[model samples]
Target: MSDNGHQNVTMITCTAPVNIAVIKYWGKRDEELILPINSSLSVTLHQDQLKTTTTIACSKSFQEDRIWLNGKEEDIRHPRLQSCLREIRRLARKRRNSGSPTSDVTSVSHKVHICSVNNFPTAAGLASSAAGYACLVYTLSQLFGVDGELSVVARQGSGSACRSLYGGFVQWKMGERSNGTDSVAEQVAPESHWPELRVLILVVSAEQKSVGSTSGMHTSVKTSDLLTYRADAVVPSRMEEMIGAIRQRNFAAFGELTMKDSNQFHATCLDTYPPIFYLNNISHKIISLVHRYNQHYGEIRVAYTFDAGPNAVIYTLQEHLPEFLQVVCHFFPPEVNGGEFLKGHPVHSSPLSEELKRAINLEPTAKGIRYIISTKVGPGPCVVEDPDLHLLGADGLPKKNA
Candidate 1:
């Protein structure tokens, strides 16, 4: 939409979902290209519960490319940020040169104003960068009227951002190419492929981790032998097994692989010289709680995975949600208001059965967890047509008050 008596303000808003890797991506083969050492698979969480909403505007009136994240302006010169912007504009120029772009609403050389915000906590190992970069690239593609094979561009911003390009089950292939063009992500199944499956995010702490993922990965890659072995020997078979499990809807197989892979990934972190401890005391207890709960049922009805943070992401079917949640509430009683503790898709909370209580005989912790966010598999990035929803106003500035 063009502002009155001014150059056209071509703006677009897009939201992208966060993906939790079932088979984690820890090391990068090429840091500049953001290529993973091994392929990893992830479940794209429902955007209604967790997502990054980004608004991008292009105009000749703008002086230079700028960005605002979560209402705070960020340096536009950051390398990864520059990479995404450069790649998208490069694609736009290519389209313009080829006379293939259908929309000339915005010119290739126009400067852009990018504003992005997340519904969840940032830099807390919740994959905020994944969704943030995905939305940024996707929004830019719409603003510049360029599309096709965009996961490659998004990957340059953040390695896992490529996986966020798809819904439900997705895999980031660790391509063999040295230039890293083949290290792209693809959807293994649509969001509708897994309806019964649910994801519960246990927010242990919202504080940013002491070690960032990229830093940890570089340290682990340079120092940890276990990381190398896991990348070469462990992940290939698990990726195949994970794909088959997702296709067949085999919870038992799926849950085991998820937990095992998470464990191995963290082990590699520990093996890093000087070591990196992403999990805390509460994280360990949650892991134990999950094992005891599963042992009680004599089956893997639930699975827990941690991604470079203290938070635990639980996977279970709808049938077991109420019961498992009841168990969680019993052990880690909410210190905050019940309403405040649980967010996202509402679930029925009931008392744990006496029989189940006998099985998981652990002392209760008053507030080991801060809150719970219940979400499920959902679609990938989507454009928002509503002008009111744009994070940036027509003046090429952030609409958010923060």
Candidate 2:
């Protein structure tokens, strides 16, 4: 696998999409191992609107393992990064020792340079870690010519990351094994499983999280009784119901469960000592708007979920998108008139009803949201075949134009 004279360099680029957990994963039994206390379900948003792109290069001449995220170089000694690198190299070595002639032994020993960037915001509680780590593990596998179930390694980077390994509806099973080897993400349904399903991400705030998920989870695990109760008694049944809802395409059930699960997750946060506050005033109003909109239709037309931040992820179907967006616009006026506020699948113009406005009963707040990302279920991480798309140049460093 070593390039001749260490002059040859091997590079691979890949992209992965973000996922919104309807059934939130808040507490972890094993922090360093990143094993969740309960199973979680999420919808993988389309990569076109929200994704992370990563490029990795391996060469014998490189001095050390280095990584750059969203332009700045990040520490490669990060325990999670080391975990992924260690696992991938271990697998490669195992394969070689097993007499697999195709395994690249020389390249496996070479150091690597990784460059990653997110098209969307980072650390703003939008599952950027999920996409980033998924992309990293996938791109590394491609660069080293190693392939198989890498979701376990991805989970080491971020507990939620394992879900990004699959597209559409995914579930992170809280495996019972003490070693956490059984814990892995599995696809509950494909992207085409529900074509009408639509998702709208309300970017309430793009600022970095006041309390990171890792620390918040640790605090919750240490203090909150509610966390233990929910993980032990609540999530198992909810997981089963959620999977059934997706398999049967039951939107109402799915939406209700999503909202309730989100509420319960936040409730656990409140139950924690010193407590974490993920929802701001803006998030509260969005919740009211969603409920009022659903009340107007006498059904669960939309549902909202939050994870470690104030941003709201709304779930609905294609037909309801335009009207719901109109409701959003009425309550939260855009900063710029007719700006490209709505992204992803284009939503047709729709008029807001007087009854709906009265039902919402809130004054329009200018710029409550930075923007809205409209998307739906998307596929898992994919290899980028075009060399021009690579973030690193031939010298194994980020390109200036990248």
Candidate 1 deviant stretches above 4 angstroms: 1-7, 101-106, 400-402
lDDT of 2 at 367: 94
lDDT of 1 by residue, 1-402 (tens): 356623477888999999999999998888888888999999999999999999888888888889999888899999999999899888888888887738573567888888998989999889999999999999888878888889999999999999999988999999999988888899999999979999999999999999999999999999999999999899999999999999999999999999999999999999999899999998999999999999998999999999999999999999999989888888899998788888999998776788887788888888899999999999999989888998887788897552
For model 1, what is the alpha-carbon lDDT of residue 194? 79
With a 3 Å backbone cut-off (N, CA, C), the pairs that clash in candidate 1 are none
- lDDT string, candidate 2, 95-194, tens digits: 8788787888788999999999999889999999999999999988877777777999999999999999889999999999978898999999999999
Q: Provide the lDDT at 313 for model 1.
A: 99
Residue range with the least summed lDDT across 10 consecutive positions in model 2: 1-10
- Model 2 clash pairs are 1-106, 1-107, 2-106, 2-107
